[model samples]
Target: MMNFRKAATAAGLVLGIVTGLVGPAAADVPAAIKERGKVLIAIDVSHPPYGMLDSQARETGSDVETAKLLAEDMGVALEIVPVSGANRVPSLLSRKVDMVIASFSITEERKKVIDYSRPYGVIPVVISAPQDMGIAAPADLAGQALAVARGTTADIELSRIVKESGVNARIVRYEDEATTNTAVATGQQKILAAALSTANEVSEQNPGLNLEVKLDMAAYPMAVGLRKGDDELKAWVDEWVGQNLENGKLNAIYEKYFHQPLPDVIPES
Candidate 1:
């Protein structure tokens, strides 16, 4: 059995090599990407609905599927590289991955370090708490424990709100969205700030927890992130996004994972 597995792996590698050499080159692709014959996309595998591992430990989610589609459209193989929120930008900057599609929100602060494609989707950062927690607003979070994945948009916005509003909430930072949601569901934390889609999944998975969105911190436009000034790759990605948006291909991917229609708030540009 082991020998058969090994032989199968070897055969697949040979097939890939042959295909890479003979496949039609994607037009207008960056030279580096074209030479590689594959696009390495960085994704936050711990963030469900956006990106996550399935029961078989294979990457599956909206962003993962979208990445696959983009690679197909580009006539290349797709390679997914798992990354954490804090390390995604650094991963791209270090040339570890060709691009990032990890629900990367476009922000003025991030634009200084990396270039972004046009908005592909929108996600709201929301504050959620147990139904009985009495946390109805951001101001109500004062003196309560709030869990958030460090380095995420939720963490940044929640921290800013606490500081600016003089809310003395205890911000408990976790390594990733899964852990943060677990903390809340297990009653270790009474409040959590996370993407709405993530919160919805957590609530659905742990129905007994009865988590409810208490406040919406902000709505952010998400886009693909490329290394700064990589004009060729950035332009290709932006054009892909535009075409997908118009053709309804992107919306179909979103609806598959989210189990709902894509929100109208997604910016066309």
Candidate 2:
């Protein structure tokens, strides 16, 4: 009677051996990937809990682990390529990566260029500000300086809201979320449009900032991104997403990193 951990390890070894012998199924993988015997997955290691480098400088996060599982399921070796929000899609389009498992929100604007699998997770874009800012809602953002990373969903949503509301808020764009968070935390910026997870990470890392979410702007579901017309890869990823969600494996990974139960927004299948 072996323990669960040992049994699972044994099962994984056997699975790996069987996968290596049988090879990747042609119906589930891109022809190039099946030829190469590996899949290149794009990930943004700057965003925590989603993708980041550990103390040993190895990629470790929900997305990284998920990509590993995806490659294993596809019976291929994994090759993670680091990418930023601005470059994740371009990397996939240029054939630099086979898929993007970063926190890529499924949106109509992106759909024009790339196809997305069913969402695996959800991230809430939030407006965070100091308690004294009096920025309780989107309308209150008028005349305030909002910080955001350019090309990100937060930037797009904040811009849209301001334009639709006819507000004259000042938007200050940064190269990345870390810099944007710094501007907001240090009082250089009055407000920040960022992911809820990012806001939490910023607050935890810099408690003196006293930042809090003033408004819930939008909730975006994240999905695997691939080049347009890749039906085989898309179908494989969709099936993987459905299987993981149903088995509680995805939830377990989410909870392990985020320290909370899987959000209700994650699709069941």
Candidate 3:
């Protein structure tokens, strides 16, 4: 088994071959890819500014721009496959999609099954409570009922912190952010949500909801994912990302959705 860095290096070489720029195989087309001159991309069309359906119901976003740039860099066309959050991984492994440009978080657990490009963005995990609730930090929520979406990284991270760090918060699982955000907004639970990006999205979309950000908890990274051992694809993506990061293209994309520039660097710690 090759490490991520090594696999990426090899993948870049293969990309060169496919583009007819280098390698002996450049003269002998790989039948698996020769007929299809497009990069199959899996995207969460519902996730905005990254991937989403427009008012006209057309698929477009910042990630779409990024994907087009990558395809250009790879010297290939792009075929985007709109997908939901739950189906992202299955689509990758089953070869239905060659890459995931969706807003996927990189985790130790997920890295085992799929390879990820270097992180492109950072999302802060916040512990949110109503203004009147008097909760200011992770510790302040101890012994109180708190809600989070089941099977999400936020729930797992909060649970780990509560158990290991000795926070007194009692965990409650909600089906989705809507219910959790509503519960918190209505003051049903002491703190109705523990999330990173989704909470921010909810708060911004609904003015009636007042969510105070508590950043004492952990922050996670966002990255693109590919099928395990697909070194060629991973290398192509890494080089494409590096180019964008250097040329101010990525900063512009970030600003379009976030109203800010991309950070100088993503904190590895």
Candidate 4:
């Protein structure tokens, strides 16, 4: 009899041969998840309202709760893989997590690497700074230091606006939302580009900083992110999101953390 590891290796080679003979195989992510009996979801606990630790130090937030509901509906155990804002994509691509639900917004750039479910929530990107800063527009940020989480929509959008507007502001990027927010709160950086909820959370934590939104950039719809070619999983996720949205459960969760209703418009994926 073959050892367990040897048997697994033999099985993999056989599967590879079969796959080669078939030319290609459609992703049966849904079935794979079912067989595993657990779904690994990535959530950014560093970003507030979307994901964070509660007073009890347990994980709790909109994204965390959403993942819990999804796992429950799918009849699978939920495994929360805590990730930083910059880690969502890498974690998915590396197969460390089955999907990401870290308030991840849909973008054409991201779509090239991964698929997304329909919009589940919306977040406003803003430039938060001291109340006295006269940064009413992107151009006004010239020569200022604006900190943002690397690889996030806030970072991408702000970089685009700065380049187009010919603003010379220094864009400082951090590995996570918490560090980005800390830069602003500690006065290491006077400005921050992040979700409105993120700015609000940082403000509440450091009231003396008096951070206020100087620029309300835009609201972006966030959705669950899956590895590319997960068509079956995407379909299931889309349907689940639609069902929850229609039943108002998604909105209830959104309102609980965001303090507002879910957005009415849906963007093209």
Top candidate on lDDT is 4
Give candidate 4's error at residue 231 in angstroms. 1.1
Q: Per-residue alpha-carbon lDDT of model 3 for 1-269, expressed as tens digits?
A: 56433444465567566675443223332234446887788886655556777789887887787777766655568898987655677788888987887767777877788899867766556676645667665667667887775544676678877888698668888754456656655667656454455566656765565666655467667778887776765655665654455556766777787777666556443
Quote the RMSD, in angstroms, for model 4.
11.7
Model 3 regions more than 4 Å off: 1-34, 143-151, 166-197
Clash number for candidate 3: 5
lDDT (Cα, tens digit) per residue for candidate 1, span 19-136: 4422113336787877899999999999998888889999999999989989988878999999988888899999999999998987777888888987778778998887887876
True-structure RMSD, every candidate: 11.2, 6.8, 6.1, 11.7
In model 4, what lDDT does residue 226 have? 94
- Measured with C-alpha atoms, the lDDT of residue 70 in candidate 3 is 66
> On residues 108-165, what C-alpha lDDT tens digit does candidate 2 reach at each position?
7888899999787777788887767788666888778889987788887898888998
Residue 170 displacement (Å), model 1: 1.2
The local distance difference test score of each candidate is 0.81, 0.79, 0.66, 0.83
- Order of the predicted models by lDDT, top scorer first: 4, 1, 2, 3
Give the winner by lDDT: 2 or 3. Answer: 2
TM-score of 2: 0.85
Worst 10 residues of 3 by lDDT: 23-32
Clashing pairs for model 4 are none
